[model samples]
Target: MGVTDEVLTEEHKIEIRRYFYNHQNADGGWGLHIEGHSVMFCTVLTYVSLRLLGESSADGDGAMRNARSWIIDRGGATFIPSWGKFWLSVLGVYEWDGNNPLLPELWLLPYILPIHPGHWNSARDQCAKEDLYFPHTRVHEILSSSLHNVVEPLLKKWPLSKLRDRALTMVMDHIHHEDTSTHYLCLGPLNKVLNMICCWVENPNSKAVKCHLARIKDYLWVAEDGMKMKGYNGTQLWDTAFSVQAIVASNLPNEYGRS
Candidate 1:
């Protein structure tokens, strides 16, 4: 529903549109959660999602116009966080240069190295890449000088080139391994969408793309009001365990003792 090409069903699109329309705030924006204040991150993504799902920008009530004004007032999409930049890039709504580099090859570092993922205390630390922009320089210029930019131009300049093929192959293999290990769910909704885009860009016909499309259904949740994308697959197991503990703590087990 959110600009996913050929991967979303008609039912999904209808439900997603219903969810967005139902949740739009009085100010014509959205928030990070149902009860939260409107934020640029949530507002922009939801607005784009609705547009992609066939909603008109020129609707009579000025819903889309109001959301656009909100985004512009908040310094626009470029000011959105890294994850927002990533999704917008995939959707072709934002330039990839706006984002800090996210190199999958970072995982290829030797395990004994101090910078290896296993050596980091937090997952965030393990994935942190350089923030390459300076206050004076333009983002495009900074990105043009990046290693990815340098190598990408060379690859484009020479088709079928073998220069970085070996290293690039290793990175691609690691991506595939991750897709398999996580069953295409990845770490969360953002990561899942990014990985799907990566797989599609790399090889639309690859098994990885198929796996991602097949498993995406797990992240959707339907409710009486409407439907929405979930942070992850259902939390039934976690909720059930917590419920059992809470019940025990309430001393309700004695009142409802097993026969």
Candidate 2:
């Protein structure tokens, strides 16, 4: 039977999503499959995912609470990098200002604006980035006008609101699917907010919003470190590794030699 059939409860969704989030490294992101080192790839997408589910930046959890600070550091959503800016844009939260200078009038200027390498950093890094987690942006198209290697797919015709709607939808679907897949242990607080965001973004006045909002009760998690992502996950491997390295520097590695 599917996991959906076995435990499929709201509580379970909370669990898995939290795993993905707490396991996420700093920068407010998650690793791919929850096994890799953290990168902005997981951070930006997961941040939005959690918010949409039902968890708010105001959540008592450290990971969930620090989201906006992460986003605004690049300048209140105005100065986030291209892909980072896109995620914010897709959520309908980013401002049109500070966007790469997209002169629609250039289309009428009769000369295609040449995309110069001078403005971008590490195109390889940009290309390697996982678009699925980031979502597509119109700002990218405005600058390049070519999709030769765009990280994420562009919404048909590049309609801002439509693309925004779709991005919002994907996160919501993820929350439902996450809950169904994990029996509602909670897909981490991020997914909780992701579920909340989906309903709010798509149909703010619908029952889904109310339901997600109410589900907030299940998302609260308490920890010795002043409330954090629930069941944050295994740290023995990482912590032990650090401890060993520290002992080695102190010439204590020989102590284990006797064993």
lDDT of each: 0.77, 0.58
lDDT of 1 by residue, 225-256 (tens): 57777797756778888977888999887875
Task: Kindly give the stretch of ten consecutive residues in candidate 2 with the minimal lDDT sum.
Answer: 224-233
Q: Where does model 2 exceed 4 Å of error?
A: 1-16, 26-28, 31-41, 58-61, 66-79, 109-259
lDDT string for model 2 (87-200, tens) is 677667786564676655655553434643243433533543455576457786455544444524554445655876777678677766765564444545666566667656
Clashes per candidate (backbone, < 3 Å): 0, 43
